[model samples]
Target: MLSAVLLSVLAVAGQEPPRDCARPNGHLETVACYGERREQVEADQRVILSRINARLDQLPAEGGVNPQQAKQSLEQAQSHWAAFVAADCRAGEALFGEGAAFALDSLDCEITHYQARNRQLAAFEARYGGA
Candidate 1:
């Protein structure tokens, strides 16, 4: 009986407790870190999309974009964005909880906005040379 109780106590002590994402410094750091990383990813996406758009826009209307080249650029952008999002989501889950609604929502929103910007840039490029 004593051995059983001791074993139970040890097991409980050995288990890692969940992190509280609400602690002042920790929570703030978590939020800030995610924000910074998300911003960096957004910046990179913007650079690529901007270049692609500028190129598209520069092409004469009579000699529009090569469909294959456009498709490849889009695929590359999407792959990069997907990788960034996966990494971000993993970090968020580790900092917050698996079911952290707010953190997940914020991350999704950031990605969504970035994608929208990318689309807009593509449209701009299609209209003008990628300058």
Candidate 2:
């Protein structure tokens, strides 16, 4: 009964077949899943950033915020955000220590950050768009 329930949960969470993250059998499997997820999320971040940059380029200077200023601001904000993600994730991982829960928790933490940042960026684009 437990196995069936777990399997269903995994299936709903992800198919991650290539890395078997949905039903990871070992540490390596989870590691692979985390790496792949991180890469995919980072790629998404890059795409959104490109879109934001294009939008910034289109909007004229307003309230002393120009394209160059917006780009520079984004770069600065991203640097701080990247650092925060790293520190927060690492601290959580360290507190969790090495175990069955470690990788999963770490992965969840990372995904949460990426998802939150994406949402924030989307909202910004929808709103003022740094203009």
Candidate 3:
């Protein structure tokens, strides 16, 4: 009986306690880290979207842009944003213990990235003649 009890205690002890992302210092640190990464992603998206939009604006109303070129530029920007977001989210999860704040912050970063990208595309269309 004693041996069984000892084994049970050992098993429980071997399991690590859940991490608390809400702890004062940890919570603050996590938020700051997420914020920094989010800002970077947002900035990059802004640049891409601005360029795309500028290009689009230059296009003629009668015919649409060159499907191939527009598609290629869009795909490139999207892929970059997606990868950045994914990596950021993963890092947040790892560092923040999947807390609600962490999730929301990460999502905000993604939204910002998309919005910026859209604007960038518009800017790009304006700068260069669109197909």
Q: In model 1, what is the error at residue 9, expressed in angstroms?
A: 42
Query: What order do candidates take by TM-score, descending?
Result: 2, 3, 1
Deviating ranges (above 4 Å) for candidate 1: 1-25, 63-101, 112-131
lDDT tens readout by residue for model 3, 16-49: 3543445524543444434444556667666765
Per-residue lDDT tens digits for candidate 1, residues 16-108, read: 454344552454345444454456657867686657655655555456547457656766867786677566556655665544355534555
Q: What is the alpha-carbon lDDT of model 2 when measured against the actual structure? A: 0.73
Cα TM-score of candidate 2: 0.71
Question: Candidate 2 at residue 7, lDDT?
Answer: 35
Measured against the true structure, the TM-scores of the candidates, in listed sequence, are 0.37, 0.71, 0.41
Better of 2 and 3 by TM-score: 2
- Give Cα-based local distance difference scores for all models: 0.55, 0.73, 0.55
By summed lDDT, the worst window of 10 consecutive residues in model 2 runs over: 1-10
Error of 3 at 109 (Å): 1.7
